[model samples]
Target: MIKIDELREGFGSFWGSVSEGWDRLRHTAAGALTRFKPGEQTALPDRGQIDDPLHFPAQSWSMLGGDVFEDEQRLVVRIEAPGMEKDNFAIEISGDTLVVRGEKRFEGETTEGRWRVLQCAYGAFQRTVPLPAAVRGDEAKASYRNGVLKIDLPKVQPGKPTSVNIKVD
Candidate 1:
């Protein structure tokens, strides 16, 4: 017999895969749109005209993607953050939420010709992921390597209730 927890897990996995696929498709479409005729112009602002380094246009931004899964004793989370260093990320677990925040700074490039296309996103981004089960935040471990951030959180074990005897007052 299939249990409810099993069904839930199956659905969660299915949805996560779908969401990741959709994000990839959207990014591909946006990149393709930037390769139009040079003479044809849109209302979008030129990268050179933007004075503020933090200003990221809506159409040019992309969010970080990740996956979460649990093993027998640990809950693991892996996030894709390409071109970022270890010091660039700030991760915290508050209550039942795991918050990952970071900024991908734009590296200025000096080229003789003007930029014809710019699709990479560079700015501050935050992603909050809810824990599937209770975990010990204090004992959590994290590591970043090869543009991927991996976190391992120890799962909390349920303990037996303790009964206290009351003395007559």
Candidate 2:
């Protein structure tokens, strides 16, 4: 009788843990799916829209995913920008920061057929990437091919030190 009671209690505890884990897993999956829903429309910001200086807009609103790599000579930045033309992007360098701004327009036929799903995000996006070291902004080269934008920023050479003699304090 004691052995049977212990076995039954252990089984009950195991079943309870399994049930709790299943519930938690289900809720986590549901929460992830609810974050981005189909047929959701996100309007693009206007040209003159001013964002808060402290906090920038969310990356979901306008995102241009990319990768940055550096070699002994130059720093290369490659951004994946599909469904866009070369004229849509504007790349600039201010101080030690590199800025890439572009607008991705959504083109779809919504009048003829019933829309079931829409998941692609489109709008104006600005990405500011700071260079690891000083670069020659004027000599920066950019090229776009097959939906990828690549920018090559050459690293600036360290300036030669100059010694000055002070006669009087």
Best by lDDT: 1
Question: Which numbered prediction scores highest in TM-score against the true structure?
Answer: 1
* Candidate 2 regions with alpha-carbon error over 4 angstroms: 1-63, 158-169
The lDDT for every candidate, in the order shown, is 0.71, 0.66
lDDT of 2 at 39: 23
TM-score of 2: 0.56
Clashing pairs in 1: none
**lDDT, candidate 1, 12-65, per-residue tens:** 999999999999988644422221112122233466855556644553446466
Q: For model 2, what is the error of residue 13's alpha carbon versus the real structure, in angstroms, after optimal superposition?
A: 20
- Candidate 2 per-residue C-alpha lDDT over 1-169 given as tens digits, one digit per residue, 9 for 90 to 100: 5799899999999999999999987764442221111122324333234343432223334235667787777888987777778987899998888888776665655454433443455656667776776788889999999989999988896443235798996
lDDT score, candidate 2, position 38: 18
Q: Model 1 segments beyond 4 Å from truth?
A: 1-46, 49-60, 158-169
Q: How many residue pairs clash in each candidate?
A: 0, 0
Whole-model lDDT for model 1 versus the true structure?
Answer: 0.71
